[model samples]
Every structure is written in structure tokens, then in C-alpha cells.
Target: MNLLFVASECAPFVKTGGLADVIGAVSKSLATTGVNVRVLIPAYPAVAALVATGKTVMTFDDLFGGRARIVAAQAEGLDMLLLDAPHLYDRAGNIYLGPDGKDWHDNDLRFAALSFAAAQIGLNGLGGWVPDVINAHDWQAGLVPAYLRQDGRPAPPVVMTIHNISFQGVFDGTRLSALGLNADQFTQQGVEYYGKISFLKAGIALSQKITTVSPSYAAELLTPDFGMGLDGLLRERQLDLHGILNGIDLDVWDPETDASIVATYSATKLAGKTKNRAELEARFGLTKSDGPLFCVISRLTSQKGLDMLLDCLPDLLAEGGRLALLGTGEPYLERAFIDASNRYSGTVGTIIGYDEGLSHLMQAGSDAILIPSRFEPCGLTQLYGLRYGTLPVVARTGGLADTVIDANEAALLADCATGIQFAPINGLMFGHAISRTCALFAKPKIWTAMMRRAMRHPVGWDLSAAAYLDVYKSALAP
Candidate 1:
């Protein structure tokens, strides 16, 4: 199988969130299946610098108002095609945001150029390499299918994967001609969404197959609450939608061999965890607690339900549970967590920005990882928590509900409890879940058993890669 991944980011070269991790891991995993996989990403300055030895395979005279070229290279253990458009992708610091901390105004045309390139690559092979299938990810590459359709040529089937429905990439319909889109297709059944051109809507409506990160999330997208205004269209295409759960790269996330953490540990040799916990405490300035040391490694955003964490802090502190949070997003939430750290001092610790090494240490040391998301599509942290024996206490929504086997009495009795889950996301329920975790932590035997079980849980990408292969084979059948 020849697979081409069209996306905005890929890990170890470029990453802002879990999507990049998924792309990097999935491409590697699929490669092991004897499938030829190549990912196309914008050549950011840093990324382009790494692939300096690459060979140019394709060029364009005018791509969305710029001269551009595609550089093909095998770098960082993956095959990548770098779209080196200096006018579109040569920005420093952040790829999506400008110096003012706002989205780049030309993101529409920038990504449209990316989609156009992907469509062209699919339609015409690059140096004896033609993709049999194109997998488009997120709103950034959402126009891949749309472009492929506009060509009216027999092109490879495109699979559209929605990482998060919240970001639909809605832009003005007036740019239809400028984006090289057929204005005649601007109908409710086409790319038009709420009188605007939605890149995501075009992919969802035109793609041969649609998938989300988790099965629970796949099912959730059919309803009004989780659909984010696309439920009707999703319902119309339900037959073509599939929910394939995401898996992490175990080699990168293994607790026993991770050099990022202070002390290595496994399910059997858990003593090293204590040392890591001590180091974590010293780093976070947290006092050693008899209760659980819970950590939150997520953005300080309302979507993450961190405000509720603020409301639930007293309950957690009263129960002797300490907190160490490391992430940055939303000014108000950042100030709140920073202020909480100040007011609570030894019991609470907060770092405004994210550090990759510190995140590994936090996972290795924390007894539990709290993820109280309002709605999570597929959370990679919970998977990392499971891999590291850091039990995940999460809301019963989307992938969190799918991944975490809540330590309810039935689950505990069955010896299958992996973490804690609470529904009806609010301060009360979240606080109750924290109390439940504390109660479990109090029982050393039960807590240890749960930790071992969590560590034993399979979180790697092998199974998901196989599932994707099946999707490709079926899409190509007949």
C-alpha cells in the first residue's frame, strides 16, 4: 500500500499537540506493515533545516501566490516530503500563530496551498511515487479531498481524520475563487457551512472514509452536543465513519527506559518511582504528602475544565492531595493556576509553560494524572499515564471514558480497575472522583495492583496501525 499523509505537523520535527505524535507514530508503525508511507508537511524553518540534504521532486510556478517546491527526504526515521514554501511556511517561533499571539491572517490561503499541493501529488505521481491513498488530518489539511474532487480526475481515495471538531477552519466564502475552489459547489451539501466555507466540512462531506481518534468520540460526533454544529452532516455520513482508538509509541513512552525521567521504573521494580516522586517534589516545591500526588499536564483552557479544578482544589488539598501542573494556554486560567500555586504554596505547584522532560518526570512520579476535560476526542496523556502506571482520573467523555477503567467497586472486585472516572463534568463530580482516588490510594495493596494493571495495559500503536491498513485495503477493494 502506498499511503500519503497530508497534515500540518509531525512529531520529533514539529509538534504542538498529540496530533503530531499520532502522525509520526502512525507513519512509522504503518511502515513496519510493509506499507510505503510518506507524510507531507509545511517546511517550517527548523524542519527545513534538518532535511537540508533532501532532493527536490516537485515545484510550482505559483502556489497560492508564491513560487514553491517539494523536498523529498528520509530523515528522523521517517519518509517526509517537505513543502518548502518560504512565503507560506518560513515563519519562526510558532507555525500557526504570529508574534501578537493570534492566528496568522493568511492561514486560509497558506493551508489551501498545502491542500492543493497534496491533491496535485495524489493526481500526478512524484518521481515514480504515486500515493494509492491520501490520509488528511485536521482542518489544516481538510481541503485535500475538496481539491481532489475539484480536479474531476481519477485520484487516490482520501481518508479524512478529525482530530478535534472544535477547530473547523471556517473562512469567508468570498475566498472561494482565491482558494482555487469551485464557487458552484458552495451548497449546504458541499463545503458551505452556515453560509461560510469550512475546510473541515468539505473533507467530511467529500472523503471516501471518515475517522476520529476514539470510538466513543466517533459516536459522540453524531449528537448535537459533541458535533459542534456538524451533527446533521455527520449523521448523513455515519455509515462511512469509524472510530479507531489512538495508541502511543511505546518506545518513546516506556517508563523503564525513558532518560527524561530522573529514575527509571517498571511495574515490577516500583521502588524507583519513590525516588522520582522525591525529585518531583523538590522540583515543584511540593511537600511530601501522605495522600496521592496528582499532576495535570494540560493546557490551562476552559475546554480542559481547569476552572473546575480551581473550584475543586480545596477538596483535593483538604484530603492531602498535592498538585503539580505544567502547561500554558488562556491568560485567565494561567493567572488562576499561578495564583493558586501562590496561595497554596507547598501543597500546589504550577509552571506556566510546558517542558518536555518535566512532563516525563511528572508522569513517572505522580500517583494519578487528572484529566477533567469538558470533552476529549482522544487523550494521549491518559494513555501515557497508563503506560507509566500513573492512574488517570478523568471525566467520562470520549476517549477518557474508553481508556480509563474506573476503579468502581465492581471494577476493583474484578481486578480490572485502571483509574477513576466521573460523569456530568462539574466541580462536584470531579471532587468526588478525587476523593475516590484518595480512598484507593489509602489502600496500598489495591493501589499497587491498579498501578500494575495500568502499566500492563497496551498503549502502543501496532493494533491501530493494523486497523488503518485494513481501512486502506477495504477502501481500495473493487
Candidate 2:
């Protein structure tokens, strides 16, 4: 059970989104299950820092028309291989973006180098350590499968996981020559997507199996709404697609042992949660109160339905509830939340950036977490909210539809509900959901029962990892 994971980012070493967390946690979990899992990522500045502590396992002179090497290291308790191509990955800014707040102009070449190196390693073993399966993640490493197929050699089975369909890594068709891709590979059934070369499309077309983050999302992607223009191709390969719901790293996310929060508390002993609530209020410059407090920790993007939440803010405040938001995206949305905080000085507070520690404290302190995403693949915040006993108010879509048992009349009566879920994903529906949560909060006994159920929920990676193992085995079949 030897596996190689190729991705642009990974947690603890470098990260820009939930993809990193998934790769990090899932790889570590798989390794524990007797699978020899090794992750390969570009040697970004943050990753390059590890070279001092790591060793150069292999070097290559014929990759991306430049010198590249594979440096072995340890990250997040998993074996890591850094594709050290300084010319392509030595930039100082974010992984995909430049300091000027735009995507790097040479991003196609940068990630192409990464994929080429991965393909090389998959075809030819690195230091006699060939992987039985190659799993490429997101559009960043989407070229791996394509390159492997183009090599026309015996290679390990390749699997591509689409973390987000929005970013397809589209580039001019003329750039194909730079990547050493044959012109014949560019076609409607190949990588050509509307006269452009689509990295994600290539992976989806050439890979033996494809997977998304959640079951609902996998189904959603076959339709035009969530497909981002590749729905037809995805439908053609629907049988080979899977939706494995992602899980959080329990050891890193558990509230009982988390060092980030102001106090540690479990479902039975909730006194520490009260202390954390007060601390959170003070930290956010909000007046302490007994009203239900809701927290939002997500990218302030339209996809996340933040505008809908903003539209319902006044109604939520009128219900005698408080809100705390932490995130940064879409400058206008950031300003909108800040303006809302100013308008409702005491009832609303916002931090216009991301902080891991602050996010944990918010999860621990808030009575409910707000996740009104219109089409989430598999939200990690809602999962974290469930783990911390902070009921999530998520839209009924994607993983939210799969993981959360909506706190309706039947579920509540059965004592199996974990959180609140609403449909339509609009301002009015979100407002109603918030009102429902506030009413639930008024009943301490019922709310506590729901919290207990949420705390007891299984959000670990064991089940999801086993499903991935099945996918890997299936890919290797025949």
C-alpha cells in the first residue's frame, strides 16, 4: 500500500485553504493504517525552510528544463518530499498569488514543473521507492495525470481529487509546448476547454478515478450549477467518481486538549466554555451578555454566502443576538462586515483577517457557528463547530447536507440532532435559521442536549481514510 500524494499546499508546512488540512490529516491517518503514504509539494519559501533540517533524496537535470531535486522531510507526522525547483517555486509571496495581490503570471509553468516532477517520480522510482498509487490534488497538481499518460510508459495508477472546481488553471493553448505536451492532447475530449488548456480537465479526463470532498458535492458537480463548465465531462465519468467526506484531525481540533482557547471544556463540564465566551467578548470589544453569540470563520466570498449573512445581520441583532466574524476576502465584503460592526457597535464585532488561535477560541466560545455557504464542497468550520459543541447553522448543501442532522422537530425529539440547517441559502432563510437557533438557545436543557449530541459526533478521518483506501484499490484493479 504505497501511495504518493501530489498537491500545491499542505498544513503546518504551508497552507492557503482547507485542501492543505485535508491532505495533511488524511496522509497522516493513512500512514498509521500501515500505508506508506508520501506527500509531494512544491518547495515554496515556507517549505524551503525545511531543507535545512531535511535531506536531498534525489536530484534531476531533465525536469522543466531546469535543475530540480526531491528533498525528503517530515511534516504533520507524514513523510514529505519537497520538489525543490528554486527558479519556479522560490517566490516570496503566497503559493499562487504574487505580492501585488494577483495570481503569478507564470503560475502555469510553476505548477507544470511540479506536475512534471511528480510524473517523473511516478514513472521512475525515486531512490527505488516507487509508489503503487499516485494521488494528485486540485488543479495545482492536475497536470500529473496528464504527464503520466503522455509518458507512454508503465506508471502507477493515478487519481485526481478536485478540492474546488472553480479554479481550473486555464491557460493559453500555445503554452502547451512549454510543458512538453503534444499538440494532439489539445481537443474537446482532451485538455482543450473552450480553446484553452484546462489543467483540471486533463486530470479528470486521464485519471482512472476522480473524487471530490463530499457526496453531495460529487453529485452537484455533475450538474451545470456547481460544475463550472465541466459538467458534461464529469457526467461522462460519473461512475468513476466518488465523494469521500473529509474529516478533521481530532488531535489538532479537539477542544479538550486545544491550547489555543482561553479555557478547556468538554460536553459535561461546560463552565470553561462560559469563561471562554466572556474572554471572546472582551477580545472582540463586545459587551458581555447572556444572549446567543454566533461566530463566522470563513472566507468572505459570494460562494460562502457571506452577502446573505450580511443582509440578515440587522434581523439577527434585533433578536438580541451577537455576532463575531473572522475572515478576509473580496475587499468589498471585508469592508461590509467592518461597516456592520460599526453600525451595531455593541452587538457585532469583526476581525478582518484569519487567526488559527482566534478561530479555535471563537469555536469554543460561541453558542453557534454560521456557515451559509451556497455550494460548499465540504466545510471544515462546521465540522469544527460540531466537535466543539457549538451548533452550526449551515446551508443544506454539499457536506453540510451529509454531515449535519438538522435540528428540526423530529431530530430534536429523537435526540439525534447536531445543528441547524436551512435551504434556499438566502437572507430570509438564513434569518429564519438564526431565529430558530436563538429560540433553541432560550431552552437551556434542549440546547445542552443538542450540544452533547454534537460533541459525541464522529468527525475523525478513520472512515474517510478507509474509503480512500478503497478508491486506491479500485484504481489499481485491472
Candidate 3:
């Protein structure tokens, strides 16, 4: 089986969020399954440095409507074809922004170039390789499936995965003609969303099959609030859509092997975890306490429910626990956390920007992780926290609901349960859940049991990649 992956982000080369993590892990896993998997992405400036150090293969000429030079480069033992259109991709900072700290106004054409380039590569032959199945991720690659379907080309089957529905690429319908798409495509059956050309909608309407990151998220998207105005379209293709829970690369996140943490520990030798907690407290200048240490490592965006965290802080502080946070987003929320840090200097510490090393430290040191997201499509931090014996306290939504089960519930909970779940996203509800967790912590035996169980929770990509393989096979079948 030959698979071609089209995505905006991939780890080590380029990354902005969970999307990169998913693409990189899945592609590598599929390769292990004996499928000839290849990836296509824009050759951003940061990744160009790798091309200088690695062997570059002559791919093919992308003759969509004009000339586009394509180059294939190998990295981390994986084959990746980088679309070299300096006019469109070569810019200063990371993707979605320039040096001016503003979104590039031409992102529509830039990613449109990516989709068309990838579509042509599959058809015209890139590096003498052709894909049996073309998998597209997010709105950036959304237009490819639509282009393949509407252009009447007997191309490879397409499977479009919706990592998050909130970021549908909607632009003016006038830009359609520039890409040689018909003007009549502005209707409901096409890229139209209200009066805009929604790139995600086009893919959802045209792709052979669709999938989200988690099964619960698949059900959530069918509702009015979580759908982001595309629920009806997903409903129309319900039979072809699936929800596959994402997996984490245990090699990178495993506590015993991780060098970032102060001490190494696993499910068997749990005593080493206390040294990590002590180191974390010393690093953050928190006073030593036997109380459980809680941490929240996420963006301070409204979507992450940072506002709710603020509202719940006073109550949480009154619970007599220490807290540390590591992430940056939304200036107001950042400032609010800073102010809270000042108010509770000894008990709370806030580090604004994200540090991957610090994330590992927190996971290894903290007794619990908080994720009160407004609506999380699929959260990776919770999975990382679980693997590190950090009990996750999350709201009942998206993958958080799907992955974490209550620690105090059923008979099998001793072996499988990992975290706590709150019913609502409000402050009081979150505070109540925290209190219940504190009550559980008072019982050291149960807490230790829960931590061991959480550490044993399996979320590897083997099962998820197998499920995706099944989806690809079905999509390719006549």
C-alpha cells in the first residue's frame, strides 16, 4: 500500500500544535505497518536548513496551471517531499505569521498552492512515486479532495481528517477562479459557508471518507455548539466518517527514559517520583508541602478555558494545594495569571511561554494535571500526564471524556482508571471536582493505586494506526 500525507505541520521539521504531533506519529507508524508512506508539506525557512545537511531527490515538475519545482528530502529515516515555492512559503517567523506579528493576508493562496501542488504530485508523479491513498489533514489541505473530485480526474482515493473543526479555512469566493475552480462552486454543495468559501466544508463534501481525532469528538461534532457550523455536512456523510483516538509516542514521553525530569520512575519503582516533586518545588521556589501538587500546561486561550481557571483559582488556592502553570497565549489571560502569581507567591507560579523540557518536568513532578477546556478536539497533554503518573482532572468533553475514566468508579477501575472527570466547565464545578480529588489524595493507598493505574494506561499509535489503515483500505476499495 502506498500512502501520501498532506499536512501543514509535522514534528521536528515544523510544529505549532497537536496537529504536527499527530501527523508525524501517524506517518511513522504507518511506515512500520509495511505501507510505503510519504508526506508533502511547504518547505518553510526553518526546515530548509535540513535540506542543506540531507540528500535532496529530484521529484517532479508541478504543472497545475504554472511551473512549481518539487523536491523530496529524507529526515529522521522518513521520506518527505517539500514543496519549494519560495514566493509563497519562504518567509521570516513560523507558519501563519510574518515578522510583523500578523497573519499573512495571502495564506489562502499559499495553502491553495500546497493543495494543488500535492494533488498534481499524486497525478503527475513525484520522485516516480504514486499514492494509492491521499490523506489530507486540517483546512490547509482541505481543497485537495475537492479539487480531485470536481476536476473529474480518476485520482487516488482521498481521506480527509478533521483534527479540529473550529479552524475551517474560509475566504472570499472570488479567489476560486484563481485556482481554476468553477464560480458555481460557491453554492452549498461546494466551498460555500454563508458567503465565504470554506476550505474544510469543500473537503467534507467531496472527500471519499472523513475522520476526527476521537470517537467522542465525532459524536460532539454532530451537535450545534461543537460543530463550528459544519455539523449538518458531517451528518450527511456520517456513514463514511469515523472517530479514531490519537496515540502518543511512548518512547519520547516515558518517564524512565526521559532526561528532562529531575528523577526517573515507572509503574514499579514509584518512590523516585517524590524526588521529582521535591526538585519541581525547589525550581519553582514553592515551600515544601505534603499536599498534592497540581499543574496546568496549556495555552491561555479562551478555548482552553483559561478564563475559567482564573475564576476557579481563588477556590482552588483555598483548597491548600500548590500549583504551577507553563504556557502562553491571550495577553489578558497571561496578565491575569501573573497577577494571581503575585497574590499567591508561595503557592502558585506561572511561566508564560511553553518549554518542552519544563512540560516533561511538570508531568514527572506534579501529582495532578488540569484541563478545563471549553471544547478540546483531542488533548495530548492529558495522555502525557497519564503516562507519567500525573492524574488528569478534565472536563467531560472531546477526547478528555473518551480517554480518562473516573478513578473511584467501577470494579475494573483499579487496573484501567487513570484520572478524574468534571461534569461542567464552570468554576464551582471544577472546584468541587478538585475537592473530591483532594479527598482521594488523603488516602495514600488509593492515590498510589490510581497513579500506578494511570501510568499503565496504554495510548500508543499501534491501535490507532491499524484503525486508520482499515479506513484507508475501505476508501481505496471499489
Candidate 4:
């Protein structure tokens, strides 16, 4: 199987969030299954530095009216093709955002060039390397399917995976001609979304198959709450849609072998976890206690339900629980957490930025990881928690709902529970869940069993990669 993955970002190269992690891990996992997977991403500064030895494979004269070329290189054991268009991708603080913390004005043109190049490769092949399936990820590469369709040629099957529907890449319809898209495409049945061109909508409209990060997210996107104004169109393609739960890279996330954490431990031998806990307490300058230590490693944004967690902080401290957070986002949220750490000194510790090493330590040391997301497409932190035997207390939404089995009476009795899940994500419910987790923490026998069960749960990409292969095969079917 020849598969081409087109995306804006990829991990260990250039990453903003889970989308990059998914593309990086899934592409590698698929290659292990003997599928020839090749990835295409923009040559951002970080990516260009890594692929400095990469050679130019093909050059195009009229790609978005600029001299664009494809540079083939190998990174993280995967074949990568970098779209080397310096004019479009060179200046970057963030991939999509400028130095002023706003989106670059020419983002539409930048990504349109990326999608256009990907379409050319999908349709005509690069150096006789035609892909059997062209997989476009997120709004960044969403126009690939549309560009291929507009080529009016028999092209490889296209599949678009919506990592997050919240960002639809809606642009002014006036820029359609500049993007090389037909004026007629700016219609209700086409890419037009309320008189705007929605890049994600174009993918949904033109791709042979559509998939989201999780099964629950797939169902959620069919409703107005999660669809971001594309529910009706998504409903029309119900049968063609799929919900494949993403898998974590076990080798990188495993607790037993993680060098980032203070101590290495497994589900069987958990003594190292205690040492890790003490180290975490010392590092964060928190008072060491036997109380349950809860960790939060996520973006401090409203969508992540950080506000609800903030609201429930007093309740959590009242229960004699300790909270530790490590992430960076939303200025107000960062200040709120920092203030909380100061006000509730020793009980709450906040690191207002991301540290990869600290994240691993937080998981290994904490009793439970909290993910009170308002809506999660597919959460990687909870999956990492499951692997580390750090029980996740997540809201009942998206992949959190699918991956976690709530430790209710039925689940505990059946011995199949992995973590605690609460619905109607709010301060009261999240606090109640934290209280429940603390109660469970007091029962060492039951809590140990749950931890073992969580560690035993499947977190690797084997099954998800196989499911993706099936999707690719289905896309190629006559």
C-alpha cells in the first residue's frame, strides 16, 4: 500500500498539538505494516534545519504562481517530502501565526500552495511514485482533495482526517480566484460556507472518505454543537465517514523506558512511582503529603475546561488533594493558575509553560491526570496516563469517553475499569470526580487494580493503523 500523508505539522519536526503527533506516529506505524508511507509538510525553519541534507526531487514553475519544489528526505525513519517554497514558508514564529500573535495575512495562499503541490503529487506522482491513497490532515491540507478534483483527472483516492473541526480555515470568497479555485465552487454544495470558502468543507465535499480522531468525535461532528456549521454537509456523507481512535507511540510514552521521568517503573513494580512523586513534590516546592496528587498537562484554554478546573480548585484543596499543572496558553488562564498556586501555596503548583521532561514526570508521579475538556477530538494525555498507570479523570466527551471506562459501581465490580469519567463538564462535576478519585486513592487494593488495568489497556497504534489500512483499501475499492 502506497500512502501519502499531507499535513501542516509533524512531531519531532514541527508540532503545535496532537495533529503533528498523529501524523508522525501513524505514518511510521503504517510503514511497519509494510505500507509505503510518505509524508508531505511545509519547509518551516525547524523542518528545513532537520532536512538540510535533503535533495530536490521536482521543481514546479506555476505552483500558486511561484517557483515551488519538493525536497525528499528521511526523518524519524520515514520518507518525507518538504515543500521548499521559501517565499511562502520561511518567516515563521508559529507555523500559522505571525510575531504579533495573529494569523499571517497570506495564510490562505501559503497553505493553498501546499495543498496544490500535494494534489499534483497525488495526481501525477513524484518521480514515478504514485500513492494509492492520499490522506490529508486537518484544515491546513484540507484543500488537497478539492485541488485534485478540480484537476479533472483520474487521481488517487483522497481521505481527509479532521483532527479538530473547530478550526475550519474559513476565508473570504473573494480570494477564491487567487487560490486557483473556481468561482462556481463558492456555492452551498461546494466549498462555500455561509458565503466564505471553508477549506475543511472542501475536503469533506471532495474526499472519498472522511475520518475524525475518535469515534465519539465522529458522531459529535454530525451535530451542531461539534460541527462548527458543517453538520448538515457531514450528515450527507454519513456512510463515507469513519471514526478511528488514535494510538500513542508506546516506545516514546512507556513508563518503564521513559528517560524523561525521574524514575522508571511499570505496573508490576510501582515503588519507583513513589520516588518520582517525592521528586516531583521537591521540584515543584510543594509540601509532601500522602494525599492524592492530581496533574494537569494541557493547554490552559477554555476549550480544555481549565476554567472549570480553576473554579473547582478550592473544593479540591478542601479534600486535602494536591494539584500540579504544566502547560502554556491563554494569558488570563496562565495568570489564574499562577495566582492559584500562590494563594494556595504548597497545595497547588503551577508551571506556566510546557516542559517535555516535566510532563513525563507529572504523569509518573501523579495519582490521577485531569482532562476536563469541553470537547476533545482525541486526547493524547489521557492515553499517556493510561500507559503510565496514572488514572485519567476526564470529561465524558470525544476520545475520553471512548478510551476511559468510568469507575462506577458496575465497572469496579466487573474489574474492567481503567479511569474515572464524569459528564456535563463543569466545576461541580469535575470536583465530584476528583473527590471520587481521592476516595478510590484511599482504597489501595482497588486503586492498584485500576492502575494495573489502565496500564494493560491497548495504547499502541497496531489496531488503529490496521483500521487506517482498511480505510485506505476501502477508498481504493471499485
Top candidate on lDDT is: 1
What's the true lDDT of residue 308 in model 3?
82
Regions more than 4 Å wrong, model 2: none
Task: State the lDDT of candidate 2 residue by residue for 1-478, as single tens digits.
Answer: 9899999998978887799899999999998889999999988889766876888888988666678899999855889999888888888867888888899988898888888888988988878899999999988888887888788999998899999999999999989888789888888867788899999999999899999999999999999999989999999999999999999999999889999998999988888888889989998888877779999999899999999988888889888899999999999999999999998897899999888889999999999999999899998998999999999999999999999999999998888999999998788999999999999999999999999899989999999999999999999999
Query: Over 4 Å off in model 4, which ranges?
Result: none
- Candidate 4 lDDT for residue 46: 86
Which residue pairs in candidate 1 collide? none
- A best-first ranking of the candidates according to their TM-score comes to 1, 2, 4, 3
State the lDDT of candidate 4 residue by residue for 191-267, as single tens digits: 88888898999999989999888999999999999988889999999999999999998888988999988789988
- After superposition on all C-alphas, the RMSD of every candidate to the true structure, in Å, is 0.9, 1.1, 2.1, 1.2
Q: How does candidate 4 score on lDDT?
A: 0.90
* Count of residue pairs whose backbone atoms collide, per candidate: 0, 0, 0, 0
**Shift of residue 303 alpha carbon in model 3, Å:** 1.3
Q: Which candidate order results from sorting by lDDT in descending order?
A: 1, 2, 4, 3
Taking the tens digit of each residue's C-alpha lDDT, what string does model 3 give over 249-360? 7777899999998789999998778999988887776787767899999988999877887887777777777889988878899899898888989788888987888889
**N/CA/C clash count, model 2:** 0
Candidate 1, position 53, lDDT = 84
